[model samples]
Target: MATTAITRFAHEEIKPKIGSRILNSKEELLAGDLGPQIRELLEQSGVLVFPKIDFNDDEQIAFTKTLGTFAPEMQDGTNHKIHKITLDVKENPQSAEYLKGSLYWHIDGTMNDTPILASLLSCKVKATWGGNTGFCNTYAAYDALSDEQKAEYEKLRVIHSVWATVFYYEPEPSLAKIQGMQRIGENELPLVWNHKSGRKSLVLGCTAHRVLDVTPMRSAEILVGLREWATQEEFSYSHDWSVGDLVIWDNTGTMHRAEAYDPTCNRMMHRTKLQGEEPFE
Candidate 1:
């Protein structure tokens, strides 16, 4: 049970012995410093894409529970209080319009009280070519900026909501529909977050609708610019999924999105999120 950031073994050795044997034999994954190292790595890098893991739903859920409370995907149910995505999302396009937003680069569940902390995604089906999941290291992006840029961002706070942007171009949103969004605004989160490791990161993305205490038009210009600046290729990594691969990212420090895939072919992936405590203080 090697630990303390041991390099993953060669895939030849790993890819072959990746069944219940490895799952049962591996202590580091179960109860060792590998857990903490993975935790630290996620906070440091904002993204962790291990090569592959032969994990079942029960095993995946079990592993995720080790980190913190699990946030199940929101399903569309009449009485469901929290957002729990229904099975029909991927099955039917008309019902999955909300998920279409995921095709664009954005943070997840930022409109809620606990802005989803971490996301654990398991790839069950692979697209022929496209469908890569892209992750932007906001921590790295913030650090690479000039001190002047950092200073400028520190003074900003953005408003977030679920539906305003979802229906942005719509001229006349129905009154009931607008109210149904359950839009909660006026959240004063910092644009620059200083992590415990002395690293700083940007926290801007699509859900961030407006700047607090700033003019609406200028705020849009600034936010659009910042998003463009932070997501440059050098600070980003794209994960092309193989069956059984699991990727995790710190939602507090990174933004992510799914690339366009041919929905005609079977494409199924399950995502579990960790609840965010504070938007990096």
Candidate 2:
């Protein structure tokens, strides 16, 4: 095992609001002292980009464990910890349709009682056209709101479901089609998540369906307004990935989406998730 002192590594802010780029080598990332620094930085900066880190499945899994507990159940059936992120039917026939939901803005595991803590994605093959991952800092968005707006939002709750996210890709999806897809059932989550760190983040995303105690139209209005507010350019970063680039984002405080790409572009990414320690309150 390698050990590198934290003082030796440097990181630069990628954007004023959301992202930080680690100015260190892949070997330094695997070092013992780096994970705590990375986790602390991740909490402050919503996303961290390790340009061209090129971590393999085993190396990615090892790094993930350093930050927090590895989510073993997040893996696909191949007995490997990495889940291949691609649109190719042959590579992921059973789950390709569900993966299309990634094209929309969402926090991972919204329907789960406890959503994922964080996600690590390493780009293996870059698409010819577009496959950039976009991240928005919901924490910043929430904090920027007027006190009155915050008060109103904090009183609200929203329902999340797999069907809501799937419908983002397929508008007017048939009931049968939605039932056929993987349904995690619906969960009612607070519109504003007050984390253990004493920070609050807006939990609005595509998976979010409607706000409680409001008419359907009013709920739609609130959800849409919050989504727009959270995803404004200043509070978000779009990462144009190169092969070997590895990125991790604080899933609890951010929403992410993949840019549109041709289905045949052969873009591939390997992903590993960190299990959540806190539930949405």
Candidate 3:
């Protein structure tokens, strides 16, 4: 099969002078056909950018559902809607702190058993400077590793928890909210997740605390070393946002983070999550 497909969609309707109209018109953008080319690119690139989308929370929520299912089913029998990661200076002040860490380099839903298949974030209010998102291809990162390292890593496992971060914000997070955080529903993560495609990526990041099969000290050293390696300048890209930008990354094989920005300035965003069905084995 052919590998490495790349497709990008952009619109001039999302510039400073004429962006507000698009956010109000989310259904059209959400319903547009993304075509097979974009799907293949998503598989190959681990990230996709829909720049200058004229989409709002309702519309962005609509678009994310088209990508995948709502992630992390709650225990209550009611499915949490796909729009789980909403951000606002007005509504969720306490959460805004933990979100500041979102500006760091990491992946989504590491705490879940299957994890989130993907996460889509839409910018409603853009900061004037330094609020771009950076994405890295974990599949590509693994492919670039030395053979010996890959061989050694194939046997390792690590512990990941949303509690580590959630408790950092709301010590007693809501049961449903905690369930979303704890999908994949495990106490740990394998250091190497072999995708159905057979590509493997390192599970090293801030949420990945330590190796399960190794000593804590050794695990820390290994995870940190590998994280530093994969995130090297060569394997990543940074995306600057204009108002109404929406970006999605595969949580299974990519790590993402927001760049620091003027938080005091308006920086509103609405995030939608995709529930994972199959586990990567």
What's each prediction's clash count?
7, 0, 11
Error of 1 at 198 (Å): 4.4
- Runs with alpha carbons beyond 4 Å of true place in candidate 2: 1-7, 74-79
Q: Encode model 1's per-residue lDDT on 114-157: one tens digit a residue.
A: 57779878777777669888878777777777888778878887
Top candidate on TM-score is 2
- Candidate 2 lDDT by residue in tens digits, 129-163: 98999999999999999999999999999988878
Give every collision pair in model 1: 73-85, 74-83, 74-84, 74-85, 75-84, 75-85, 75-86
Between the candidate structures 2 and 3, which one is better when assessed by TM-score?
2
lDDT of 3: 0.65
In model 1, what lDDT does residue 240 have? 83
Cα displacement (angstroms), candidate 3, residue 115, comes to: 1.0
lDDT score for candidate 2 against the true structure = 0.88
Give the alpha carbon lDDT tens digit for every residue of 211-274 in model 3: 8767878887897787787777767777787776777667788788877777677676667777
- Candidate 2's TM-score reads 0.94
Alpha-carbon deviation at 149 in model 1, angstroms: 1.5
For candidate 2, the 10 contiguous residues with the lowest summed lDDT are 72-81
TM-score of 3: 0.75
